[model samples]
Target: MNHFPLFADLKGRRVLVVGAGPVADRKIALLLAAGARVVVGARAAHPRVLARAHAGEIDLRLGEFNPAWLDDAWLAIAATDDRALNRKVSEAAAARRLFCNVVDDPELSSVQVPAIVDRSPVTIAISSGGSAPVIARRLRERIESLFDHSLGALADLARRRRPAIRAARPGLRARRAFYDWLLDGPVLGALRRGRPDEAERLLDEALAQAAAPPRGRVLLVGAGPGDPGLLTLRGLRALNEADVILHDRLVDAGVLSLARRDALLIDVGKAPGGRHEATQARIHALMVSHARQGRCVVRLKGGDPLVFGRGGEELQHLRRHGIDYEVVPGITAALACGAYAGIPLTHRDHAQSLTLATAHRRGGACADAEPESGRTRAYYMGVERLAGLRAQLLAGGLAPDTPCAIVENGSRSGQRALYATLENVENQARRHAIRSPALIIVGEVAALGRELAWFGEILDGEPATAATARLAAA
Candidate 1:
């Protein structure tokens, strides 16, 4: 973010390069290709520079560096070996209010040239603000490999057919969909197969055909915990294709950023002290309304939507309205927290089964809840009701010494796991000031967090008051 990325229109402009080395030669070649009027200034000119000058391809001055060389120059590049000389050029360009690049010198340069992947009319630039050029170059190579060379031809076709595309699909949403089809469908395939005529004919026929109106559909996408990397590929695709995204508050900003730039983002997460049911109703309404408008709506929830995420409720509502929808499941908190905390939920020596439970119910905590023998019970959203849950477990003949672990911000960089026992879980949670969005695991496997913890901090058994853990919920 340190450098603002831009695609400057250097065509028909003048540029000055104050070096004759290979580095300068490379920069000069790129500038010339960009249609810049190149002027080379160096005490000793390279053979290539001399040849370009002799061929009237460039205006070359063989002499000491001069400030006058930057006159009428739209941009300047100082690629010389002398740091002082490059600094001088940078200062001179700064005085003229012209952007300049000091090769390999971030402090002296006003702008850093980025590594590029050029699919002409669709150029992608990667930069580390001149801090890590090698990394940028590596990224460029990866991007280059992912895109086909014929992509430029596809872009050219799109450019030529834009007018017809607009006329055929006047609606903005429909137009965008059509453009997506052009990229993903047979048009790009035809061009990639080196059949330009076939590609053009396909485009013409697609535009000539009576296009169906865009249909609205809902996609339930699971955003796993707080890590963007944990998102499923199907979830990522749903996000990119969404016209409207209604996401939970727990959904990370990094996850939301993966969606289309123009997609409308709405936070539909219920907040503390808010009417939960009403909030859910509003979310349902929003989804239905947007889908009815023929827009692709995405209900993005953290963790598996069906696993205590109320995804089933949303699906039922969609079905009542006969709306089209798809589900992309995500890694639930129980699984994520256990793995991240290095506590296997179903260790053969500890637990025989796994129970996914909610701490609070509509009627309140299930007072008569029974703990199954040798089962690992993962309590969702249970941080605030730990005391009540502890009492219920104890009343139901659960062992007082049964091990427990509270995982906060699971799967995230700031994750913390607090290990305690059923008898002391409430006390330990109170001492730690555990917050919501935390998951509670009650079983012998929970004790493994202390010895097996890997991803985050672990708060083990301690008697000191100052050693309080801060376990916050999502």
Candidate 2:
């Protein structure tokens, strides 16, 4: 509520980034990507920034931070960790009403940066104010796994043909319906296989047969979190036929690899570096354009599209537009991450109610900004926000003694888990040096993990054994 949710058009804009370290480098990277004329005020910069400067991509000012650095700047970022310096930079920006970030200090920031997942032509952002950056980042990562680089090509196809499609279909609803079909079907499959020719051919055929273009339909494709092996048959089928894949950052890379080679793989993923409505709009447009062109369109997403994937908004859009789209369910991160990490999402005695909560607000504000209420909780982006999450859960009718389990890199090699009671989980995670791209499950069932876990048995540094004993126990 404190900040407006809007994309700042950085193309041809001036952005001053104060700092040359990782955080400074991070902001500068995004500015440059938005086609801004970026200038950096720092004593020294990372090699990547230096390379950009040498290549004439940025203007770098060496040695220290100064208020004059804000002169004539359209936007600024106080990437320095020095709170004092960040505050000064922030004050300068506020005087001019120019946007600025104080890195981890949102209180001093005029703008807070969110995690971004970019596949050109399509981008997604996830924020959590400054309360839990790690959780926001993990959520972003989950979104990223749903799409690939092919989305650029998908966007290009639609852009090239938008005028004709609109002209042919006078009704916005009808036109949107047509686009919906093309995206989820042939167009997607064709592109995924690196066959643009096939995409065009199938599109023409479908259009020739339809009154307008093809009808749009909703698909419920499941992207099993982190483990490509966990994807279902229908999910794989849907992925191959996608025209516009709208995904989050936490999806598995291996799952994305299954998409057709030339498919219009979109990264409608919200994470750390990329955030914008342009990408979201582009996704809808791509679906509409392709469906109108009589190309099969797929709105591929991470997990079940209905679960925090915002499939509902899309369905509404499709309905209003009179597009025929179907919902293809995906494996929600909680289910996949928990199962693969040796923890069931729910159990009879452990959890009477299961809740999925976003660790962030709509504009990337932390849960502290507006803490969610839940019991028997499983958090999608709670790694960085563990402390906040723990506090919130404790306050929200959940006992402080509730058992919690942290799953990192679930469903794939390198998966690790940390189990503890609610009161000690935050400290446990800190003590164990846990990081982002992890999920937190809190409840009694989480305690059952030690007893019911088989994934850990496989990873327990012991060969798979005791089949007879396991059967007897079961």
Candidate 3:
């Protein structure tokens, strides 16, 4: 964010380069390609510069660096090895109020060149503010592989049909919908297969059908457990396409940042002591209302929506209303919490089975089930009921010394894991001042966390107030 990215109109503009070496040669080539009238001033001109000058491709002046060379220039570049000469060029450009780039010296340059992926009319530029040029180039190379040479042809096709498409679909929304169809339909496929005629035909057919109203749909997306990286590609697509997003409070800001900037976001998460039924009713109403308006609606839920996330109710409601919908699954908390805490849910030697449950219902009633032997149990939102849950397990003939771990803010920067026995889990959590949005793991595998821990190195029987441990965990 240190620099605002912009595409300057340098076509038919005057540009000055203060060197004729390899560095200056590269800059001049780029300037010429951009349609800039480049002038190279150097005491000794490079062979390529002389050739270009002879061919009348560029203006070459054989002389030492001079402030007069910057006259009538829209942009200036100092690429000579002499630091003093580069500094002089920069100062002259500044006095003339012209933007200048000093080769390999970002501190003196007004603008730094970016690594670009060129698809002619479509260009993607990436810059690390001149701090990491190699990294920027690496990123550009990765992006280059995802796109093919056919993209230039695709852009050309779009440019040619824009006027006709706009005239056929007067509404902006309808026009955008037609383009989306064109890109996702057989037109793009035909282009990729090197059949331009077929692509144009498909485009014509789509344009003919643009008068029809666009269909509305719903996408049920899982935001995953705290980490944005865990979000699926399909989920990201749904977010970008959504006209409105209904998100839960537990969905992190990082995940929400991926959605369309102009998309309306509605928080449907139930607050403490809030009526669950009424909130659910409101969510249902919002989904139906938005979809009926021919808009794309996204119901974003934390973790896998189907796993105790009440996604079934929403799906049933959508089905009853005959709304088109798709579900994109996400990594649930059980997996994220266990991995981040360095505790596996199932181990061949320790746990052969796993059980996921909640300690309390939505109404705050104790829904604790007896802890089955030889099975790993993960309890969601159970930190507040640790005491009651522990008592219930003990009453059910569970061992008092059963290993347990409480993972707070799992997969997040503030994550903490406290390992203790079932008998003292409540005390350990209280001593460490544990909070909600935590998962409790109980099984023999929980004891393995002390040794198998990789993410954070907090050991069992150790005090949780160690600053180094928290920093490492973060």
Candidate number of the best lDDT? 1
Across residues 353-459, which tens digit of lDDT does each residue of candidate 2 receive? 67787785576544432323333577876787677767776776566655678877777677777767777778778887877777888766666565566663222
Tens digit of per-residue lDDT, candidate 1, span 26-54: 99888888899999999888888788889
* Segments of candidate 2 deviating more than 4 angstroms: 1-220, 243-247, 276-278, 363-375, 456-474
Off by over 4 Å in 1: 367-374, 462-474
RMSD for each of the candidates = 4.0, 17.5, 4.1
Expressed as tens digits, the lDDT of each residue in 389-414 for candidate 3 is 88888887778877889888888877
* Backbone clashes under 3 angstroms, per model: 6, 84, 0
Task: Give the clashing residue pairs of candidate 3, or none.
Answer: none
Model 2: per-residue Cα lDDT at residue 29: 75
What are the Cα lDDT values of the candidates? 0.88, 0.71, 0.86
Question: Model 1, poorest ten-residue lDDT window?
Answer: 465-474
